[model samples]
Target: MRWGTFTSSNSVLLLIDHQVGTMKLIQNIPFETAKRNTLALTKAAKILGMPIILTTGTENGFQGPLLPEFKELVPEAYDARIARSGVVNTWEDPEFRAAVEKTQRSHLIMAGVTTDVCLYSPALSAVEDGYPVQAVLDASGSPTELSEQLARQRMERGGVTLTATNTLIAELARDWSRPEGSELLKLMVDDVLPPVF
Candidate 1:
């Protein structure tokens, strides 16, 4: 796969299944760590003025509603969130796919709870459908280390670029001196990074 840079103008943020009950299934990383990173990405994306697409799976069932913080951070995306009835792979959901297409962005930055399922399937599907996808690993997790590893390998093999929250933020920012970059750096300090001392 050829390497490329994703800019705020060319990329859309797609957060999938970051729902309450679904998040509880993540065991590969501390739950708070995953939540924090995911929130940080949301804030960073909002600061950069990127289009965001939010999705949930069977919210009325076990999946539960998407994390309320998203609604507070990017209320428009949350309000327009695609609520999948029973679709496991978000890419297969027509509404979700259409929403992403409507963004008119070529690259996708995605994160989801339970990396093995909520993230794995749709990411691969998106890649196969010819979209350049970047999966934010730290903002997502799996039920176990083995599942996470296997999913990562599969995603890599399937052409999804695996990335971390800080890396994605820095890549998008490109220059810390810019006002948006400075705000993103502040987001990193306040939400994603530990104290320097």
Candidate 2:
């Protein structure tokens, strides 16, 4: 399958370990920018009617909960957000696996905090499991710029597609004529597009 062709029905959005603590530790991109991009991805996923699975390594301990802004974008009933205490790789967590299974999607759209750990682990695992996985680079973070770049290279080498959040939104939208296109445009305005002069 062409990596660019992603139908909402055939794709699932996986947000892993986007907890407050980890988000704050990201130095490669500004925390607010990462948050904005992540919010864009979540809002786009919701507007496109895609199944969403949100996971965190640990809530009460060091990781903290998912960003409040991110949580607010995802409706509780429409998406599944799981908190696992000890799993470094969300794919290794049974609940996360079950939620992915429930989506029944062949293509996985993913991004996460601390790219090397939270993002790389599951993305490569899913690819090994025969799922076409795409990682939204701008929406993910790492402790250092080098680490982030290396993680992306590792995933690309492992057959995972690397793309930006806007690209994913465009791919999912497919055309600007659709009603959802306007919604996606609004999201881009809030999170990505340059301000009007």
Candidate 3:
């Protein structure tokens, strides 16, 4: 697939199933690392004035509600979040699909809990629907390394571009001298990056 650069105006952030219980299932990476990267993506999107669509699957069940920090960070998205009752693939949910369509942006930057299920399914669906997707791997994980690896392979094969949080931020920022870029840099240093000893 020929890739186009992701700009703030051309991309939308899709955060799926970053709920309390679902988050606990992430074992391919440290829980804190995933959480931090997810938050960093949220903060970066806010800085760039990018559209953010937050979704959760069966929140009333084991999935649980989205993390509290999302509400505190991006209140508008949190308020308008898509709470799926039983939809495993977020793209299969009409409201979630509509929300993505409503954005009208062609590029989707997505991160979800349990990469094998939550992130994989919809990412492929989005690609099939003719949308270019960038799955933020560091912000999403699976319960095991094998699941994570398989999900990554499948998504890559399905034409979803895989990226990490820092790369996505830099791609969106474009220039460090700009105000938004500066703010994003601070977010990276303070939230995303691990400390250097």
Candidate 4:
């Protein structure tokens, strides 16, 4: 996979299946940390004006809706909450595909609950469909460490760029001179990452 920076116009952020029940199943990382990183990523994307897609899967069933905290952060982005009948892969959902197609962006920055399912499946599909997909590792979680590790390997093999929230923030900033650069720095220290000094 060729590495490149993210420009607001060329990239879109996807927050998928971040439902309450799903969030409770993550065992590889602290649930609170994953939620925090996910929120930070969303806030950074919002500040940089990146096109975003917020989605939930089987919300009317056991998974529940997108986390209220996340919804509160990106209230303006297109929200796709799948009803009782829904596909596990959001990419398989017509509404999701339509929203992605409508964005016209070639690069996708994605993070979600259940790294093995919600994060990996669509990432592979998007790559197959010709979109460069980047998965924010720390922002996604799974039921077990082994599950998350295997999912990461599969995604990497399938041409998805496995990354972290900080990397995405830096890629979007690219230059310290840009006004958002400072905001990015503040986000890094204050929210997305641990403070240094």
TM of each candidate vs. truth: 0.98, 0.94, 0.98, 0.93
lDDT of 2 by residue, 72-99 (tens): 6776722457878888888889988988
User: Model 2 lDDT vs. the true structure?
Assistant: 0.85
lDDT accuracy of residue 103 in candidate 4: 84
What order do you get sorting by TM-score, best first?
A: 3, 1, 2, 4
Find the candidate with the highest TM-score and give its number: 3
Q: Write the per-residue lDDT of candidate 4 for residues 1-197, one digit (tens) a residue.
A: 67476677799998888888899989999998898899888888888888878888777777887788755777666344333256888888887888888888889999988998889999999999888899998999999999999999999999998889888888888876778988888888889877567
Model 3: lDDT equals 0.94
Off by over 4 Å in 4: 78-84
Residue pairs of candidate 3 with colliding backbone atoms: none
Per-residue C-alpha lDDT of model 3 across residues 151-170, encoded as one tens digit per residue: 99999999999999998899
Write the candidate numbers in order of decreasing lDDT.
3, 1, 2, 4
In angstroms, how far off is 194's CA in candidate 2?
3.0
* Lowest-sum lDDT 10-residue window in model 1: 1-10
* Residue 187 local lDDT, model 3: 90
- Tens-digit lDDT string for candidate 1 (1-197): 87478999999999999999999999989999999999999998899999989998888888899999987899899999999888888899999988999989999999988899889899999889888999999999999999999999999999999999999999999999999989998998989887898
Q: Rate the local accuracy (lDDT) of all candidates.
A: 0.92, 0.85, 0.94, 0.84
Better of 1 and 4 by TM-score: 1
